[model samples]
Target: MRDASAVITKKLYEEDAYRTEFDAVLVSVRRKEDSVLDVVLDQTCFFPEEGGQCPDRGELGGLSVLDVQIEGNEIHHYLEAPKDALPEAGAGIHGKIDWPFRFSNMQQHSGEHLFSGTVHRRYGFENVGFHLSPSEVTLDFDGVIPEQDIPELEREVNAAIWSNIPSVVRMTQREDREGLTYRSKIDLEGEVRIVTFPGIDSCACCAPHVARTGEIGICKVVSMIRWKGGVRVSILCGKRALEHFQKLHGIVVQTANDLSTSMENIFPQVVKLKNERQQLLARLKDASLKELQYAAKEIASDEEHALLFSSGAELPAVRKVVNALCAEHPGYCGVFVGNDEEGYSFVIGSRQLDCAGLGRQLQETLGSKGGGRPEMIQGSVARKREEIEGAIFSLTRP
Candidate 1:
């Protein structure tokens, strides 16, 4: 028998992706101070996180394998359940991987390959990056892609998926890797694993993928964002795509019923509501400006300080009122909006005193927060109205 420490766990996942469970002998168990056990198995179907794919999680002998890692060509399973007696070295254990999670990853990964290959061939752009999760896959391209071309690209991807092309994995020796071009993010030195989709693409990857394009079911480009002078596209494949579409459809139906409109007319109704809102806001701003001007004139005297409080008022209107008062008197003019517990939105200005200095002094006195230019300052303060007014009146004494 090979030395326990010298044992290399067979990677059953690499050979047969459908293999969900395996019986393996424990080679060694290293006990830690924290009571967790790191066990080395003679064989495992669990895939460790590598090459941008998340690691597989499952059960080992009724205990959870919280994590699996690769160290020095040996796969170590990090087992939890500290209170349970640790399995001895050379003991047999049954390992079962979460099949649904593994299959979801496989579908998204394989779907990305097909879609990225389509993009590369159609536009001559390189797939700069790829990320696969259980819910979605994102592909980053090295160059800009025209927005007009996205719909056609999506069509091409779905066509390939419907074709049910075989995804073949071939292993080749280092010296014989000539004339076999494939897309790879890193340089390879040892035996290379090539994943090829007939009439689509070939790339070097170690992650387990679905055996056929049709297994991806459907592919949807849900979103695209400009990233690092390129483009990042979010995709949903297979059941993920179905679930996403169903959720969005539900939202649309709810919106249509709420608006009392048909699904096709939801867009026009939303636009109408937005336009009406803009008109109402314009009228309200006009009325608020008039009201503020009237309130400013009602101050009665060119006093050293004038303080006003209004509820649910616009900050811009408050600033205008303060400006009008500042134009008339060389005193501190301020406005406070909102309530005591939540703090007040304040705008203060002065021609006689340095507004910035006054703001700093108030912040120091009340331990508040805010700042400004020499003539004007604006911020929110947690202090109450009476306390704030008293501080300002004291600072602006003639």
Candidate 2:
């Protein structure tokens, strides 16, 4: 393996976060995998994946940069291109970062810092962990922030953003940092890079950020859930926040239209429909019970097996009818609810046979599902009534 630690790539991004283009000389190239080369340059404007933040993406030598990672002091640019097509070591190369992607990450990180700072100030909760990616951003706090206080906390973050506070980046020398108070998730060994938003937050960090809070656009706290002993808060910022809110607004509008009500009354309409559905179901159940009783009276008093096909009857009504038939008949008695096309839910009981065995036989023969005790069984089957009747009625006592 090549000793890349000996050769440190100059970090242009540390000097200028918005440096989208840069010229450099290739220092080394190693094959990472098929069509992927880990190319190191003398200097780079790209930011590698670090500190819970995703790497900056773009192109190097006109080939797509797949990912970036840091090893010791060297930044490895994983490029997607045939080895022969890439420039050799010592050759001049050009690198470009996708500005939109980089800026979006900056907004999210800055927004997170602002929110965490607010929580720390008010509740003394430390940000235990954080993760930032293109699709999601989450901050895990060491203590719970009251749910009611979150709205105010979120408002405070946006208020700071609208205040347009300038972000200050400075290295606190280990010698001069005798009594420095800053938010840090870990103990520092040497000089600490402190990112500060005056009167908002001051935290030890290494990632490049927006010049001012206003550039963050917005921060929307989407959810907070109990995690570990504290809470994990998910937020959306800048373009992602806008996109998320747009989708949510679309759902509300469509739901209101479907409910035949104004957007503001969609909730009330939904509640009303839910109540009405319950009332209708109760009426249907009462009618099904009466129908089952009438059908029970029509069965021959001395039949070998009493079987009835019922429609729209609930499970309780069907089970009641089967139990009543079983008391007066010598063989299996069952009530099936539903038609040939939709499949059937059944309740079978017997006074003189093992219904559990019958259920197993039906399951193996008819592709049905369910089971119960020896005296009774409940299950569903997909076969037509003609096949089900023939199977149950033809059975003799075991």
Candidate 3:
């Protein structure tokens, strides 16, 4: 194992200078059991995923910096490398990030602050939770806001964006920060970064954010539902918000054309069509049952055996009919078979016969197994009609 002390360094707060790119000295390298080295730099632009914010992704010294983590105010950089001579502790290194991804995160995170702040200010709703992931940023409110109010909230937040209000980040002493409140669920022990969206929202957050509300472009409330005794709102901000609208607009147009109706009337038309389809299905099912009942009466065998088999009907329905018929005729044997998604279900019953022994005979012949009382046996098997009939005939042979 390499010296752990040589591989840890100070975490540079990069959001303070979001656009800057610079080099740093290799401060240490810690070797792990897997042979990969954890390299530390004297200063870094890599932001570790913390405080509900995702980690900054970038490369260092032409090698992929797979992860950035903070331990006791020190930042450790996990790197990907095969076994090779490691860079010296004091070696100079270059670092760069895919700026687009970083900038997008900044915009989305800032938008969340504004949205959460506005909710807090307008409705006294606390932001109880937050998650900044690769796909979307989500926030959970501490209380429910009515469905009718969501669009109004969206409008107000975007109005702030259109106003082009400048956002400011300030650090204040604990005493001076008193009475000047912000949204934070966790207790803060030291200096805090207070992000303020002017005339709109404010919160104490460690995540990187854009300089102005207008930079967030558009804010969209994609979904809102009750969660954890409160409400959870999933939002798409900046480029994500724009992309969501574009995709939904395309779908709306396609649906309207397919239905030969205007987009405005699509919902009512769809509801009407669905109602008609359900009614037709119900009528078809009733007619099929009536036909089955007629067929059952015609095929009622005067012989001691009652055979019921149907490919068109569901197994459950066929079994119910067979059970009813068996209950009506006490001495006769019943065998019900029907095709289903699981291949077939065969139910055999006779008040006077040892059906368990018959079931065992069927299992041995058809490679299936099930058990029941001496008078009735029920089970399922994956077998064709001919194969099942042959098995049953062999068990009942004279």
Select the stronger candidate by lDDT from 1 and 2. Answer: 2
What's each prediction's TM-score?
0.83, 0.91, 0.83
The sequence of per-residue lDDT tens digits that candidate 1 reaches over residues 1-398 is: 34655677888888888899999998888765465778888889998877767788899998888888887678888888575577888789999998988888888888889888888888877888887755557899988888888888889999999999988998878876788878888778888888999889888988888988899998888999998889999988887888898999999999999999999999999999999998887887677667767777888675667778765568878888898888877778888877788888888898877989988898888876789897899988888888988888887776
| Top candidate (TM-score) | 2
Instruction: Candidate 2: list runs displaced more than 4 Å.
Output: 82-86, 300-303, 310-312, 338-343, 382-398
Tens digits of per-residue lDDT for model 3 on 127-152?
Answer: 99998888878899889988999899
Q: Name the top lDDT candidate.
A: 2
Q: List runs of model 3 lying over 4 Å from the truth.
A: 1-17, 33-36, 246-262, 294-306, 311-320, 323-342, 345-347, 356-383
- Candidate lDDT scores, in order, read 0.84, 0.89, 0.76
Off by over 4 Å in 1: 1-5, 32-35, 134-136, 175-177, 226-230, 297-305, 312-320, 323-332, 338-343, 349-361, 364-367, 371-378, 383-398
- Return the clash pairs for model 3, or none: 6-28
Number of backbone-clashing residue pairs for each candidate, in the order shown? 0, 0, 1
